[model samples]
Target: MPRGFWKGLLKVLAFFAVIGGIAIAVLRVWFVDVVTVRHNGMAPTMILGDRVLVWRDARLERDDIALCRHPQDDPARWVIGRVAVMPGGEIAAERGQLRLGRDRVTHDVRGQVRFTDGETRHTFTMSWGTEEFDDYEEHLFFDRADRPFALRAMTRINGLYLLGDNRAHLGEDSRTFGPVQASGCRGEVFMRLTAAEGGLPDEIPHGALDILD
Candidate 1:
């Protein structure tokens, strides 16, 4: 091979190596998972045709956005919602809802909440509350009327419950399925890259902050 041609080829190889390294680093930082917006399930919070990134192994905090997978024996699917409740915590949904734990409290849809010490209260939106609780219970096998689906506690270390603010009116969610396991969670969402037009109010600032473990 010509001396000049050999040098040029080496430079090309070096450039590709650098590009490959960058790609790997990006993937490691931002765990990529493709989630399909099934229905108006998380509407007003998340819309259809929206693809998101979940920062795997990111520092989790109150009100952090997340992309979660469905529970076992069900469809292999994904849903996007905020971290309503995390591990070692108890979150109640409806008044008569039945959860494993006993501590129950009444909370208005848009009411301000107080968290445990060292925790901050994030202004979360109830994009949609249960529209037809009666309808849902009438057909539920466990007699939802007497026992509302309650994910009262998280026994596991990384348990998380994600719910659509648009409650009953929406489709599948913890209300329908149950609390999502930590293993099912894909990652945390730090930024909404393309579909930034319609999203939750400015209650929580919107930006891409470096995800810390």
Candidate 2:
């Protein structure tokens, strides 16, 4: 090949590289980002190890799945949940059904075991107000001592009330740690990059991709 041919090829490669770098910078700054689910709290909706795309400026609404900084854990760590209650809304859990104002949102489960944190397993029959497991039941129930089935006032304010899709997962949402501040939300999960049949990679088939609803 001639010297001119080599020079032209090098210039083209450099130009494409520059464009790719700019595109990555824009995505990191203002567009979208990818995050891996770290827990099974949002199971059925989002399993553990699922890769999801989060839109930074997406408008949040009730029932939207989102990623937020844990209210009681390290600020840098993230937790994913559904927006059960938005700002300017009153939220409480009566029995196991979630009540936003007068409307009650009940999960669809008929005595199914949703999750197990340890030796203790949680079922849909056990309401959020009831203490089923002798160990850690007090921590899982959100109601205050005075109000048996109602959430504390700390969770009803200028923030969002998030709940795990898997209602049986204890100590995994506003029910345990309180509501997350609006500012603490990282972004709303709008897409799923990769999917698996189970929470682990071993359970995923050779080629399976599922889009989140």
Candidate 3:
């Protein structure tokens, strides 16, 4: 080919490269990010060492797992939980269950899972099960067969009501903190990236990636 033809091809390639770079930058800044699961707060759903993809600036709704910064202890740390109660509803939680206005959130028994906490220095087994709220449900672990779910007071959230899947004392979430502002919640954790070596708990097996519920 002529010199001019080669020059034109190179320019086109450069232009496309610049555009691709810009798109990735925008995605990283305001659209998507990856966060490692440091806590068993999400338990069987998302365990420690689980690298998850967060969709930044997500339009959150009930049952959506919100990714937000830790309000009290560390500003740098990211916290995640399910949007159990929406902003509009009259939030009231009692007897291991949550009541949003008239609708009562119920837990439908759906077997159980036993997994050890890879994040903690102390190793122990945690049993979890799927809890249902009408038709919609999530994998929320209350406790062992002997222990009942602990009750929590409703702290009115103008933005979002976040709750961890593992409702244990160890789970640091809105249970430990109060309700969080929706604006402060960065995004929603929609997918778990493929587990690396020692990336997940031994109990929960996954393939390339996990499309979260």
Top-TM-score candidate index:
3
lDDT, residue 54, model 1: 59
Root-mean-square deviation (CA) per prediction: 13.1, 10.1, 5.7
* Model 3 score (lDDT): 0.70
Clashing pairs in 3: none
Q: What is the Cα-based lDDT of residue 207 in candidate 2?
A: 26
Clashing pairs in 2: none
TM-score of each: 0.48, 0.62, 0.73
Cα deviation of 109, candidate 2, in Å: 4.7
TM-score of 2: 0.62
TM-score of 3: 0.73
| Cα lDDT, model 1, residue 79 | 63
Ranking by TM-score: 3, 2, 1
Q: In candidate 2, what are the lDDT values of residues 1-213, reduced to their tens digit? A: 999999999999999999989986898788888898777676656666678888885777777777889988888888888777777778766774456676664332222222333223322223222222111111122221222344554334568888775565656678788778878887888777777445222222212245443
On residues 30-124, what C-alpha lDDT tens digit does candidate 3 reach at each position? 77898887777776677767788899889988888889877776777778898877775456666656666667766655445444456654444
User: Which candidate gets the maximum lDDT versus the true structure?
Assistant: 3
Q: Where is the poorest 10-residue window by lDDT in model 3?
A: 196-205
Each candidate's lDDT (Cα)? Answer: 0.47, 0.62, 0.70
